[model samples]
Target chain A: SQQGEEDPQALSIQEGENATMNCSYKTSINNLQWYRQNSGRGLVHLILIRSNEREKHSGRLRVTLDTSKKSSSLLITASRAADTASYFCTPGGSGAGSYQLTFGKGTKLSVIP
Target chain B: DVKVTQSSRYLVKRTGEKVFLECVQDMDHENMFWYRQDPGLGLRLIYFSYDVKMKEKGDIPEGYSVSREKKERFSLILESASTNQTSMYLCASRLAAYNEQFFGPGTRLTVL
Candidate 1:
């Protein structure tokens, strides 16, 4: 199973605060991607970190991958009300059974204003 | 921009009714997928197509089916809609197996 399980199923934070989420997988991966989903909208890709990469950043979002540990983390800096959304991690690779894209249960983040 | 569109934003159907949800992508991607999302279960793959008329069952494909007769279109069908089938259906398309997938707005299906 390439599924990544997100830690801290839910998180609440105040505006301007930084929130961090972690994900752990049972198997190795070629790449890992983080996504954000608003209340009822489709997922928007945030960042992708390849297995060889240690960390990647886009805007305020930072994603890190540690294949040796089969774990990943996503950090959001200076959170805002508009940043309130559910975050998910997906692990994909070139190996068989990686095409299914089994996503994690997700971490629901609530940024209070 | 990669564009993926679904046929409906919300749909209501009764049990035992045949339901059809359609998705279309403008990027002409060869890989398309269907997934169902619930409150706590995250996203579960229902089916995927690698090419026209080629479909593969995903993690959860018991009561669902998919069709890809054209390169740009994929459809998910509920043979007999059930109450348990109520979920947010998402469609995504990828240029290749390792590329990031572009998702549609999603269709919220309510089975009564």
Candidate 2:
């Protein structure tokens, strides 16, 4: 079974519009991270929110994590055509040296210009 | 900048033939992972190595095996190439916790 599952499998919005994608996981994770993939390439890390942090911000990207609900959300404010990509959420363990990051199916966002 | 390099960006192989996908990271990171990306399934981990000669099976490791002969390099091997095995193979290296992962461009494999 997949540890994380993203909601709203596909989303579309015009350029400059805000986009939000949600991910739900079932586990006691030390932290959750967001990543973006353009086309068929490998994913690029976006933001990471630890279990102790509720919300985090980086540039136009904002991420919120609710440990009680085991859910996380990534918000891309004022999206651009280049923001059109597949977004994924991943959970990592607290172990001193945990290597694997369990990934979700991902949400595909289309920013129409 | 840390660079994770994949030997091939695109590859084509015949069914029943053996295939190998190579990934190398220059950061000297101890953790290396291999994943396969599909349209709806996103990225599924195939294998991971935390240290040289160490391997761990991921969720969908059925037809795939991995080898980690050195700290900075990891290899994913397909014992018998099958059409179903065709996918976008990704390699990533991370330090610890939920830290940012440096990813390679990825190898798009097609088994016909």
lDDT of 1 by residue, A1-113 (tens): 37888988999999999999999988778889888899655688888889899999999998988988999999999999999999889888666655767787999999999
Q: List DockQ for all candidates.
A: 0.70, 0.70
Instruction: Report the number of clashing residue pairs per model.
Output: 0, 0
* Every candidate's lDDT: 0.91, 0.87
Query: Per-residue alpha-carbon lDDT of model 1 for B38-97, expressed as tens digits?
Result: 987889999999889999998899999999999999999999999999999999998877
TM-score of predicted chain B versus true chain B for each candidate: 0.99, 0.96
Q: Worst lDDT window (10 residues) for model 1 chain A?
A: A93-102
Model 2 collision count: 0
Model 1 RMSD in angstroms: 1.2
RMSD of each: 1.2, 1.8
Instruction: Give the per-residue Cα lDDT of candidate 1 at A78.
Output: 96
DockQ of 1: 0.70
- lDDT per residue (tens digit) for residues A1-113 in model 2: 23578889999999999999999988778888889988655588998888999999999999999999999999999999999898988876766434678787789899999
Q: After superposition, how far is residue B63 of candidate 1 from its true place, in Å?
A: 1.0
